[model samples]
Target: MQDYLKPTEIIDWQHPQVLSLARDLAGDRADSTAIAKICFEWVRDEIRHSCDYRLNPVTCRASDVLEFRTGYCFAKSHLLAALLRANGIPAGFCYQRLSINDDGAPYSLHGFNAVYLPEWGWYRVDARGNKLGVNAKFVPPEECLAYQPRLPGECDFPEIFPEPLAVVIEALQAHQTWDGLLKNLPDRVSVLNS
Candidate 1:
């Protein structure tokens, strides 16, 4: 739980801008759930999905995502987690393996957040930035993620990580552009077991 709330190099909740924004989002809300929902919606609606918009720089860290106003799904999750953690709520990362083409093969990891609400314990939310055919909401006890794992090799990973996976960070850092990141997205979850 402490790990979930702690700022890291990637999560970076302690960063000045992130901290200020977190306070702004919370904005007189005393309930953890309300704060979480506000933070979740802010990231989902305010931040642009890098690949979806074809934006550049391939941000990984939370602060970078907020600064750029655009990021891939993984980077967006980082910002959401940071905002939640900054507001004194625990948040963790979750992933799903899905076919990039929605058919088969070329499966890549999709990242999102699982926040610990006092009433619901742990709840997952996807801040991947909604578009036509993709809607992710912060309704506790009932998840409405951007995509479902329906394809042959797709799966919803059970573990909730305190920080973004190393592979995800690596991919974001390695790729300089949104298109590059899209082409070389990380696919393996075996590292989680290792």
Candidate 2:
């Protein structure tokens, strides 16, 4: 995907934080899959998920997830992607439409990331709101397509992030690549780091 291959606007591949952490992660030594696993676990436990829209962008980088961080799922995924990309791993953002009931309606939708694992193709990970696997209203790890979003600001569910998920999803459906997904994202994705 040329989109994924192009440099990113949000992730600072040159920051000392990025360089130091990537170096420490065992470049070229550890298998890319293992490194991807390590990065996934780091994101899983590190960032606190929230829908806050303003925070320092520099710190908002995924590296901050380890230092001091809070963000919704997309923000969290950005950080995870940055961390992996640091160590020369190719990572991409994934989106899905999930139908939910309870936020004053019969249904709604949300998005999360599916990181590209060279050996694993793409592995889904949700790093926001709460851990899954219990009391999930519907089947999770859902395909990005095949569902619907209810309304704007329907922030009733404890999900990985908040809306405008339609922007990214539509882009993915069209471009079938990372840059495609990013084309629809805000100039700067928001975050909360308190």
Candidate 3:
């Protein structure tokens, strides 16, 4: 629990700006659930998805995402994790391998978060901005992830990690530009076989 809340090199919840924004978002919200909801909504709605908006020069750090108010799914997850942790909720990373097309081929890693609510244990939520058909809400004990596995190879990686996976960070950092990052994004992540 402490590990999830602690600021890391990437999460950086302790950064002054992050802390300030977290406080602002959770304002007048007493319950942990409400705080989590507020933070989740703020991230999901306020932060524009980089690829969706076609913003360039990929950003991986949580603070950078907040400062820019734009990021890819992975970067957005980092920001959500940081915000939740900054507000005293335990938050960790989760992923899914989803097919880019309907055929269930060309799968790639998609990022989201699992937050531990005092009453509900760990709950997964996708703060990826909502569009016409996508709506991710913070409902404990009921999962509403951003994407559902529809094809044969598509699946969720259920592990709740204290920090972003190194492979994800490497992939984001490897590509300097958004188009390049999106183009070369890992089609597969080397998760341990269950």
Candidate 4:
């Protein structure tokens, strides 16, 4: 919990701009859940998904995401975590392996978040922004992830991380363009059969 709230190189919740935005979004909200929801929606809608918009330059740092107004799932998750932590809510990264197009082949790692609410313990949310077929919500007790594993071998990784995975950060830093980053995005180390 302390690790989740503390500022990190990637999460960087303590950045002046990130702190300011968090204060603005969660303004006067007494409830942690309410504050978390406010922060989550702002990141989901305000920041455009880089891959979705085909934007270039992979933004990894939370401040960079705020400045560019765009990032991939991993970068977006960093921003969301920063916002929540800035508001004093514990937030962490979560990942899932999804088969593109929901098909049973060609999988890639997808990023989201897990927030620890005092009342609810911990809940997951995807701030990747909504699309025609994908809708992620801030509801608790029930996760409204953008995509669920439909294939027998696809599954969500339940580890709630204090910061972005090093492998993910390295992958983002290795590419200058979104297309390159998307093309060689990280994959799960192993798949679970369910």
Q: Which candidate is the best by lDDT?
A: 1
lDDT of 1 by residue, 1-194 (tens): 89999989999999999999999999998999999999999999999999889998899999999999999999999999999999999999999999999889989999999999999999999999999999889888999999999978999999999989999999999999999888999998797666
Backbone Cα, N, C clashes tallied per candidate: 0, 1, 0, 0
lDDT by residue (tens digit), candidate 3, 8-75:
98998998999999999898887998899889999999999988898866888999998888888999
Better by TM-score, candidate 4 or 2:
4
Q: How does candidate 2 score on lDDT?
A: 0.47
Q: In terms of TM-score, which candidate is strongest?
A: 1
Which runs in model 2 stand beyond 4 Å of their true positions? 27-29, 51-67, 99-109, 129-194
lDDT for residue 76 in candidate 4, whole number 0-100 = 93
Question: Per-candidate TM vs. native?
Answer: 0.98, 0.55, 0.95, 0.95
Worst 10 residues of 2 by lDDT: 185-194
* lDDT (Cα atoms) of all candidates against the true structure: 0.94, 0.47, 0.87, 0.88
Better of 1 and 4 by lDDT: 1
Q: Residue 3, candidate 4: how far off, in angstroms?
A: 0.9
Q: How far off is model 4, as Cα RMSD?
A: 2.2
